[model samples]
Target: MSVNARRLAAATLATGVIAGLVGLACIHLLHWIQALAWDMHGGTLLEAASAVSPTRRILVLTLGGVIGALSWFLLFRRNKAITSVSAAVSGTPMPPLRATWHALTQVLIVGLGASVGREVAPREMAAAFSAAAADRLGLSAEDRRIIVACGAGAGLAAVYSIPLSGAVYTLEILLVSRSGRAVAPAFLTSGIAVLISTGFTRPAPFYTVPTLTPSLSLTVFGALVGPLLGAAGWAFKQAVARVGAARPRDWRLLLTLPAAFLVVGLIASRLPSVLGNGQASAQTQFDATWAAGAGLAFAALVLAAKTLTTFLTIRAGGWGGVLTPAVALGAGLGAVIGLPWAAAWPGSEVAAFAFIGAAAFLGASMNAPFTGLILVIEFTAQGPTILVPAVLAVGGATAATTWLTRHAR
Candidate 1:
């Protein structure tokens, strides 16, 4: 190679090493902070909130929504200078300090009761840190992109403890337009970050899952379910989009925030148990043995609520992605249907089907089907048993979403 080519190679190698270390520190530190935020603060708030009168619970939820909304409205509207993480990921993406601050502040909204999670804000922070650092180190555009990808992947791996899935998610979600490039540097960095963060993590399997094998007939049947789930995923996307576009105050801070608190409080207050991230409840539904009508009803309303919450925040101009709520919502859907399918289908457990539902909708809804599959595997540790239903449910969801949006940009 020529002299310049040799220097470029050397620089890339050096940058990758530095990123591995930086990504490690950033990922672990953030994970610890986030864990504390959710576990200590969020958990405390939830328990306390649950004890209050129904009216108090609604007020709490609404306040959370207001904070979340106020956060977006203030930051996004004021800082014309800052660029968003989504924009950065696509063509020449960069995460400057402005974006970083914006991301950091948004955490309160979720942590306090915004009916959302921390993944949306922190993931962006990781991506911004990686991309910005790569650029500072004089990496090429292509190289920087690769480094950013790794930083994000590493961040995700560190956060979720599924380093492999994180590595894959970094590549899969960012490759929305279907680019064939791989971010090897990012993968390497993310892997290193996971190792460093592992020391700080508590011992607990993210999700406990049984080993499973698919019968040929069940495998084929799952393939058929994909499209239906895809359609469901598409509907969810549309619901959020609609609420995002609804009239002012309908979902906005001045009006929507109160409205949101009212709705959330009303439902959660009455149910007394369906509130918060609802992950526990969603998991229960996934056990595949819940009553059909009850499960189905809860899932339907949650799907609606999740879609509305996401829309009001993003479209009404809240600052976060719809991913986590989508995950919970999707899991609920799977649980609801999984129970019935288990009872009615030839031979299958609700857990298995619920697992598939979560993966399929998560993948299809975000246009990152592979990430969905990997996340489910990482989240539940279901392994190859997850593959068949994943193919059926996720594949179908992707195809349907693609078809539904074919005419749109």
Candidate 2:
């Protein structure tokens, strides 16, 4: 390798290591905060919610929103912000300290029971660190962008333990580049980050799925139902963007934040599954234990509540990712849709539909179908039996979303 290439490689490796450590730290911090705040063990936010009283849940969420709003005001409002990983990869400069603060605040917000995912913090911090390092190394703009993208990917991989999906996220979403240079560094960084994170934490898939039979009829059903999920995903993305755009900047902290939190608290009081990023709810849906009518009702309520709360969380200035909530929403929607199917086809499992819904909805929302598919596979530890139906669902969703997006434009 040439001298510059070698230097770049070393920088990328260092970035990955730093990102991994930061990701692990964020995870630990979130757990510690949850333990202290909710007096619950190390399960997810949804699990923690179950242990607390409804009144306590309301107080926690409201208090979290207040703190999150204050943090945003103090830390982010003054800074000329490049708050997005994609922006960082596109060469928008973000100060490392400011970015770190942004990340820390996100961790605190999620830990305090905000209806949002904690995935954004690690990636933003990683991007900031990589950007700063690249600048100090005096690398070219393109090189810096690639390094930042790699670091962002590494952070995601470290958190999720999905190395390939992380690398693909960098190329498909962040960098939007297919060049060999970008691909090689991203994969290396993601792999190294995953390795580092695994040393600290056991490799546990996020979701557990029962044995499922992938029949031809299921594939056909997946194809038929997938477009609804796609439309839902598209609508979700649009609604979030619209809410963000319509709300005034100053109103977010003072007016919108508390109100949104109050609404979320009210929703959580009834359906605790709507709290947090929806991991527990999705897992519940995957269990397929509820009776048909009850399952459908619960799933429908969760889908509605989660969709609204997630939108409110983003609109009210909560810092988090939409991916988990999207999966949760999809799973619930799928379960609801699958209830009748299960009745008609005696052996058809609602869990299978939930799985497909996760992929289809997430893929369509993100406009990255393969990433969604891979995430579900890694999350559930499912093999080829699930892939054919998943692909059919994902493909149908993607096409529908794409067409809708174009027509909407």
Candidate 3:
């Protein structure tokens, strides 16, 4: 290789390693906080939450709100706002120190049982770190952008052990590039990060899923329900965007943030499923057996609570992602709809329906159909046959969301 090419390759390797380490640190920090707050040494967030007293839940989250508000205020007041991962990839500078602090604060709040996804923290940190490293290496702007995007994907890959999905996230969502140059580095960085993370994290899939055999009923369900759920997902995405656009940034956060988190705590004291990212609730839905009437009502309630809390958090100036929250929303949709379908379709599995809904909803919400599809499959490590229904669902979802987005503009 030429000197420049060799230097670029070395830098890419370094970015991947840095991404992996950042992922680990964010995760470890989150878990540590969870343990400290809820005494959650083992078991899921829901279990830990359930064991805690309602007063404790309310107190901890309220305290988190106060701390988060103060920290965010200081961070933003002291520095120019850190650009998002997409903005960074598009040539906006991401000040590394500001970005790192932003990412770490995100992890901290989420660990305190804030109702937001933690995935963005690692991705943002990885991007910031990569941009800094690339600048120090004196790489070209194009190389820096690619490395930053790949580093983000690598961070996601390391955190979830979903390498292919991470690469797809980069190409499909961030860089919007699938050329040979982009493709190779995206996959290389993600794969390397996942391998490195395996040393500290489990190699098992992110969720616990039962054996799901594809059925004709599921195929039919996917074809029929996908578009409806797609529209729902689009609505959710729009809500988040609308609230985010209006989110507090000034002294108002001191009041709004604590009020929002207090509301979440009040609800979580009753539901417990609404706390933290949507993972625990999603897992609960996956493992649940949805019956008729009551099951549908409960699922609907949980979905509503989860959606409201997530929106509230964002609107209150809490920074996070909706990826996992969207999954939980979809799972709830599946359960609510699938209960009736089960009564009619005889052999339909609600869990399988929930899984399909999750994929479809994620695709629509993110407008990244392939990444959503791959993430679901990777998270469950399900059989290839399951993809048949998932693909149909994602296709329908993509079409519906695309139409809605175009019309809304």
Winning model by TM-score: 3
| Alpha-carbon lDDT, every model | 0.58, 0.81, 0.86
Worst 10-residue lDDT window, candidate 3 = 285-294
Order the numbered candidates by lDDT, best leading: 3, 2, 1
Best first by TM-score, ranked:
3, 2, 1
Tell me the tens digit of each residue's lDDT in model 3 across 46-116: 88999989999999899889989988888867553558899998878888778888888888889998999
What's the lDDT for residue 322 in model 3?
86
The C-alpha RMSD of each candidate to the native structure, in angstroms, is: 4.6, 1.9, 1.6
Q: TM-score for model 1?
A: 0.78
Off by over 4 Å in 3: 78-80, 200-202, 290-293
Clashing pairs in 2: none
Measured with C-alpha atoms, the lDDT of residue 126 in candidate 1 is 68
Candidates 2 and 3 compared: the better one by TM-score is 3
For model 3, state the Cα shift of residue 370 in Å: 0.6
Q: Which structure is stronger by TM-score: 1 or 3?
A: 3
